[model samples]
Target: MNHASLPTTDLRARQARRRSLAFLLFVLVALAATLGGPVEPAVKLLDESQLVHATTAAPPVEVAAPMTIEQLRARVAAVLEREGVPGVGLAVVDRDGVRWAGGVGLADRDSGEPVTADTQFRVASITKSFVALGVMRLVEQGRLDLDRPLRELMPDVAIANDWDATSPITLAHALEHTAGFDDMRFNEYFSAADGAAPRAALAVNPRSRVARWRPGSRESYSNPGYTIAGHAIELATGESYESFIEREVLRPLGMPTARFRRSPEYADRLATGYDSPDQPALFRPIWHAPAGALLASPRELAELVHFWLRRGDRGGPALVGPEALARIERTETLPYLGPDTNYGLGNYGDVSHSARSRGHDGGLPGFLSAYRYFPELGVGYVMLLNSTHSLRAYLEIRALLFAYLTGGRAVPPPPPRDPDPAEVAAITGYYGYESPRMQLFGFIERAMVGISVRPDPGGIALEMLTGGGAALVPTGDGGYRHWREGGTSVRLTRGDDGRRILVGGLTYFEEHSYAWAKTRLFALTAALLLIQLAPAWALLWALLAGIRRVRGRSIAAGEFALHAWPAAAGLAWALLPLLFMHMARAEAYTTANPLSIALCACTLLFAACSAAAVAEVVHASVARTVPLSLRLVPTAAALASFGMTLYLLFHGMIGLRVWAW
Candidate 1:
């Protein structure tokens, strides 16, 4: 048996078997890559600016001077003119009533129609606040219970939870986005059919409704959660969610002008939305009608804010009691995040303008709106913008309002208090984002937002995945009470998997070991470099193959398959996402659409080609005689393609049907 390593034929046969086994493994991986789910990541292909979100600091801007109502209006006009914002609606409120409510700038640019207090704009996610109000109203009336499991209420709606026995999904969990459901899928995002009921939104993509974690354990914002709640409202009452809101919540709170659909009144006074000052943003009729489809003016929003200020009392028998209103503002689920002041029912707690504020920031495509109320000071403001890119203008307007409201009595945060070295060491590590708003984009969020807590002389430096960091100084009670920017804070705990966790104000981060961090770094570097360079290598081989054929020189079958298949694989990889992005922008691209079918087909084809390319490489290495130079690039291409296939397989994206998924 040891006769100088046996005969060459025996050795060759053994190598061929190993090659066959590897090729079979590649085929299995290829099959696995074609089955991705339908969750959406909100890829807006029209505007190029939002594609990059580099650094995030506290949104509130500090001001040096207080202003009168006249000064605030003048400053708003200046901001609109300078920043090229089409229009803005502002409402200021105190304990007594709305102080001022109106608009500044043109509502319709072409006709020069001036914006007024009645010019309605889409309030996007601010619609959730109204949903909470309706639920609380129902809760008080003894029709709906927040504590009852969703399964018992609506047995028809599809929901999958692993912990159904011990902890079932409740109305409170869904309203708070703690039901552990994934956000709406790609097809659901682009499902823009008009007059579709709240129940219709449920059928868009039900597979995404499966819980990713235990119910009520964490908070991840989801539009579908509110829509589901809307359907539940329909089940509880014999009418639609809009009808219920209008009857029980809106009219009772004295906001008769607000409507979920584009009624005749809403259409007449609706402000034209803008991507910028010059570019008009067309209205999208997405299925998240309950979550993001409220059309209300600054004046209507004033009434809504006043309802909160008055604590459910409207001068006639109290609609919803003070305790229910208090429960709406309290964060009871995630005690680790902010205890009593985080994302409660619908209105989240904030510390903008040096004040503890409870509000909601509504951002969709065309319109952006905000509702910030200072409960302690008995004041609040609602600001709405027609243009999506007018965040700076919004901030400026708020800062001016903050100055006028505070009257130079804003309390500054305590400065530079460092924790002990032992405490810093206990908390320092690589922490990954665990609870992502959108499950589809969780990978990207994990990569970009991962933080590293390093000990500093005065405090600890909180460094992000993308390079820059902030040196955080501990001020309040030590351990997790240390304040970062704004009202953001962090605490250490354990995830359900029992991994050490760093719980922040809005995000949950699980600790990553040092070895895992190094491995991830290496993988990231390899993926970035290879995905870019593999195509180049394929391109070079393509040119050579073309030249060989032109000169009438016969190319080997093994060599041709090795290079050619990988080139096809690379091309498919590049075009699939681009095609999806372009297709997603329009309403034509539904799950049943041909383009959606084609996209899935292309993804499957990509995996097949990658598998074939790798199989050829293995076969050639064993049986055929290819030069090192000829084999190197093609091998890299095959490996790179295979790596991507593995990624797709791992993420359940292999047979990704955009429309159906």
Candidate 2:
């Protein structure tokens, strides 16, 4: 028994040593990579010489009557080439049926397979329109109620509604994206495989199920909300969402090639998606299929568009009554969020210069598609592409096609709103919205996408610090309309703290002390870089000490402790990105993951280490043992590290458990 205990204790000791060595090695490797040069991405922008054949000339001012198919093909091809899209499928629909259908480029660049009218492309968010139609069909059949609270219908489903009694989530709210649910988190979005069922996919990450605000109070685009709606449809009809939609909606509407699941028969016809003309993208199926997972040929999409143009009538089985169709066409608006322009039930409503248009545009990682119908003109258009780079090209094609069909010029640009320099100046500052839902990474999230309001010609420009910029036109009601996109506006209000709060398009940005926070981040980054040099510093110091000892000089052992603790703290800082890279690749970077729990622990350890380092530096500084110049660097490093740690703590990044929230 004593011998057995001795062996077990030895094994435990060995395991502990192994773990310690593994951690040390990991830290060393992470520091090495961090010090490595920046990584270069695969795709690079093409130069002007490479774009010579892409037809960068201006579009023709007008086209002759009864435009030939060759003319349309040439124009589309030019746009696709110019935009670097690998392939595109187009369908032109009129009152009778699909008038013309064709494709312009390669479906599979490797195989050199040409895209055709029947080649299927992921329709992305356009799948929402189909799901909306399914819900309306159920409503028409008296199987589901649009206004009824979703909790009432699917009692088995778990949804956290803080406004339970006051405003429960309704079917309408889910369809219109006013359900107050957070958008599907990172883990939920990329973790699910193609075959995962709707409810199973949602179960992977349930943190997003909790309402971020009161249901129906604001409109936010939520993919999970629509998946819930689809689940509700299955519960209501006692049929799988796909089967019901296929039989009642797709079959009746003559959209035979349109379906959620990828069939083996159509695999060859499916266009290969690409991140760029040369880079093939993986076919990642959307977990929330009801929101954006349908693959359809341009002609198939055109058929659906044609049916909608006829207003719930396809001369066969009526999908929904005309009244229900009208309701679907009606756009929803909130007092603070403004009108969700052209955003109806899975559709968008808009008035161009010549006709009223209703349709939806969809974009995934490697695909973009648009389906727009002008009911007044009795024409519909479907454009599907395998690359997202084609979006600008697709928009231009839509505008040009509309102009040709309606015999009118492109929609006149909205007149610019008069400049209010005073108002602009007053609002010119940095604003941030920290989402309580983004539990662990809220600090980085807020910092990355903060808003900057700057003075512009019209009134002011609201620019996302990360990238996108849009002009804001004064609406004179403490509101401002988006310059390009009508029906979308932002309302500004003064919070009790005297900070201005901007409410727009399902998001709110409160004026933040961005300057102070930004300064701290810059300081922290500089300190971290310097801290990464600690290993080199230690090695040099050890070498010099050994040389001195060989020369009969004594080395001070106490000096090791003075440098060791701070170096250890610096090592922790270097390890952060390494841990993040591991999690991000697995699509488990969200707070829901166990790895995120480890990350929070690391953050706490870092904070403690930083504090200890600061205390050590202060003690040395007071003792006057270290040179002032040497102390200055370590002092700054420790202070910056402490500030960053505090920042993370205050912003709820440390020890945050999103699942509990």
* TM-score of every candidate: 0.83, 0.74
* Residue-level lDDT tens digits of model 1 in 1-661: 2224558887567557546644643553353354233423232222111210110244346565546777777778888999998888888898788988988888889889878888898888888988888888888888899888989988888899999998899888888888888877766764456556877888878877889998877777677888888887888788988888888888877787888878874577998888767877777777878877888889989887787777744473266788888888877655343422367777776654565677777766667788788777888888888887656776787777767777667555435464778778877888877788667667667766677888877767777776776666664333332342344355555555666676555566778765666567667667546655655676677688789889976455356566666666766676576557545544435556766776777778778878977888898788565666788877877887888788777776787766665
Model 2: per-residue Cα lDDT at residue 134: 90
lDDT score of residue 323 within candidate 2: 88
**Which parts of model 1 are misplaced by more than 4 Å?**
1-66, 81-83, 190-195, 310-317, 335-341, 390-397, 407-410, 414-421, 475-488, 495-499, 540-561, 587-589
lDDT of 1: 0.71
lDDT of each: 0.71, 0.67
Worst lDDT 10-window in candidate 2: 47-56
What are the per-residue Cα lDDT tens digits for candidate 2 across 268-360? 999988776677766777678888888899878878877876764447457788888888877443334333333568876543223446677
TM-score between candidate 1 and the true structure: 0.83
Error of 2 at 382 (Å): 2.8
